[model samples]
Target: IGLGVIKNVTLKSGEVNGLKISEGKLAGFIRIRDSGKAELTAIGKFVNSKFFHHLRNSLILATLTVFLTLLFVVPAAYAFSRLKFFGREHILYFYLMFTQVAGGLGIAGLIALYGMLVKLGLYNKLPALAIIYAAGSVPFNTWLLKSYIDSISPDFDEAALVDGASYLQIIRYVLLPMALPGIATVAVMSFIGGWTEFILASLLLTEENQPLSVWIYTLMGGIGRGIDWNYFAAAALLFALPVFIMFMLAQNYIRSGLTVGGLKE
Candidate 1:
């Protein structure tokens, strides 16, 4: 019987008789059906079966993205903070302005640009997201790091220079250790931003590679007949826990980094 083939199935008022079952018979019929189908239906309603895989994939990709952002951001932050160069201020300002104007949605144009690059064989890839995330973080991280760098006494760099240390040596040996607290601050911020970033990742990544934020949004009454709330909450809580832990651990460094440059005489 159709009823035996389907388990835990809910029929509307009209469809009950088409399967030759009255409303009263439907419940008993569903209860006697295969246990596997019943379990599947329950799981589907409870856990958003459509997006469960996407959610898992997003968490993995977001973690990688956070790591990648940190790897690039630290060195770039160091350069912007300590190195004197032509057009430095202009570059900083330009990035600042761009960040201000362009939000998650603003990157749609960039996504199109990426598509064009992809047609030239460069689309829907991890490297593309990495490049965008790194570039996007540069201005803010540069300013943040510059402030921290300014807080460090130039005497340290001067002392290192007197010892015939090259610029690379100075950064590695002298500045980097002193800048650890600030670096920690940048690392936390950049990682969280990338983890929560939805639009660009959603736009740039294919369905198989979509981030958690995008995956969550997929459950909201669009892809299926109804929205699944219980699953959405579970997934959201899982996505948020890491960010919460990261913030709590880095709170002290963030406070110190922010306050270090203030109160100059």
Candidate 2:
């Protein structure tokens, strides 16, 4: 509705009633600014609130998710890529099937997971959240890394073995170096996944233990409190800050990781 009346308005010599329409995209700016004002005006209300604490919780989960994903995915990927073992093909098929299992682990499964966590005394905790994130991410990360690792020549592994270097040493110095971009991709994906995740965070966490996603959810829900939009926008923008930095730092590796995988049999 806001844009409907503006499109056909003929500006008189780039002036609309003495307002310069010729200036930088003022129409779009006005639209955004108008909408943004409501959300941006309450910034002060969010500064010292649970927003920061939730952000810290999110950071802990994202960092731990990355760490755990790397530990589990990297070694699993290397083994799948370089090692020939009994039922290797069957194992790959089973893994691919298991990846499909994640999709079915939806709302019902989330509740069941929460129940199990509560039973184990792990619910409402950052470590519990990180474990969930890592479990969800490991399959795809391992598959992607395996595809990239396979693209690397087996001769590197053979050469390391001939030099009396153990498989672990070869993986550390050779395959790991070759798969650095993929590793960054995995880390970024895990970080972002844990960072933006909402449902589980909201369900499994409480109060200050909640992450930014849930924090923002509650902020948006205070309809009776005339919820401040400025604070909400500020919180959102703050929530996005770390991921933006991650992308800027690993921009090149992100593209390479996605494309380099699946290039070889």
Candidate 3:
């Protein structure tokens, strides 16, 4: 039965327990004893609604973007940390400088660039956001990962190489396992960063393709009216809960990972 129809029922007697029959209503009803179950059902329904669906999709997209970032970041960082190559230090310095300088101010140029892409029929696309988020994450992720990789013992890679393992094989069998802690750190950081990212997402996405942050922004007034504080608060809390949960789940990994490469001498 609908919420409106639920009010039509009247309790009859003191000792009575009967769902009063309605004409064309009352699909189901639980007593006060079943209120807990009813509440759970309602909450489940709400979470499965369109609002939650978009929230869920945005979270998934952010997560996937982070994972893709790690896919490239781990290897790149390992190479930068372990391999000797020309211009390597220069590249690292460039990335550090880029990270330091490329903050909110760089966004206007990026927005204009995406706007041009949109005019070319690529606006509000997931790939665009993914590409942007992935690129934005790389500098910090690479540097963080490089630090972790540098802390690892070169003896492991040497031993693996002496065992006739190819570079790809060594990466898969040796480095990845040893770098788990660092990987977790990068993944968690990237996921958290992308999950709560608003400005870039807002600029890249249109109404139909908007992420939760953009959608939540829409609840505020455009003209003269005040904000919808209630809806805004609810949406904000909902948006925050997943990221909070994600961090809580990864907290153990992050701590253990950080300590994994500590001093041996």
Candidate No. with top lDDT: 2
Where is model 3 more than 4 Å wrong at Cα? 1-49, 222-230, 255-265
lDDT of 1: 0.64
Candidate 3 lDDT score at position 164: 92
| Counted clashes in each candidate structure | 2, 8, 0
Give one digit per residue, the lDDT tens place, for model 3 in 1-265. 2222223234332221322333332223322333422211233233323566568658766877787898889889988988999999999999898888778546658858776867877777776677677888899899998998887888877877887988888778777766877787788878877777787777777766667777777768688877746556777788888778777777777666555433223
Model 2, CA-based lDDT = 0.74
Check candidate 1 and list the clashing pairs. Answer: 118-122, 118-123
Which model is ahead, 2 or 3, in terms of lDDT?
2
**Relative to the true structure, how large is the alpha-carbon lDDT of every model?**
0.64, 0.74, 0.70
TM-score of each: 0.69, 0.77, 0.75
- Number of the candidate with higher TM-score, 1 or 3: 3
TM-score of 1: 0.69
